[model samples]
Target: MRNDVRALRLSGGLSQAELAGAMGVSRQTVNAIETGRYSPSLTLAVRLARYFERTVEEVFHVDCD
Candidate 1:
């Protein structure tokens, strides 16, 4: 899985901590997501998309091989 989390966060001028707070997760979790070390649950994904005013497809992408 890949996502535009880092770019979105940067564009919104939000730190990992800030985005984590907004998403109700730990900063490490946000970091992990942005770094592709972790994939969020569907609920979390939805929350993240909503927070960024985007759809889940806009934030996350499935890298089909």
Candidate 2:
């Protein structure tokens, strides 16, 4: 999966640690997600989308690989 997490977080002026804290996850988790090393679960995805005031499709995109 590819996501706009990094861009969004940066645009929102949030650090990975801050985002992780807000998301109730570890900084590593946020790093992994931003780097496409890990994909968030559906529930977590929804939470993230909601937190950013974006739809899941807007936040995350299928890589089409």
In order, what lDDT does every prediction score? 0.95, 0.97
Q: After TM-score superposition, what is the CA distance of residue 58 in candidate 1 from its true location, in Å?
A: 0.7
Residue pairs clashing in model 1 are none
Regions more than 4 Å wrong, model 2? none
lDDT of 2 by residue, 1-65 (tens): 99999999999999999999999999999999999999999999999999999999999998777
Model 2 Cα displacement at 1 (Å)? Answer: 0.2
Error of 2 at 50 (Å): 0.6
Cα lDDT tens digits, model 1, 1-65, are 89999999999999999999998899999999999999999999999999899999999998877
TM-score of each: 0.94, 0.94
Off by over 4 Å in 1: none
lDDT of 1 at 22: 90
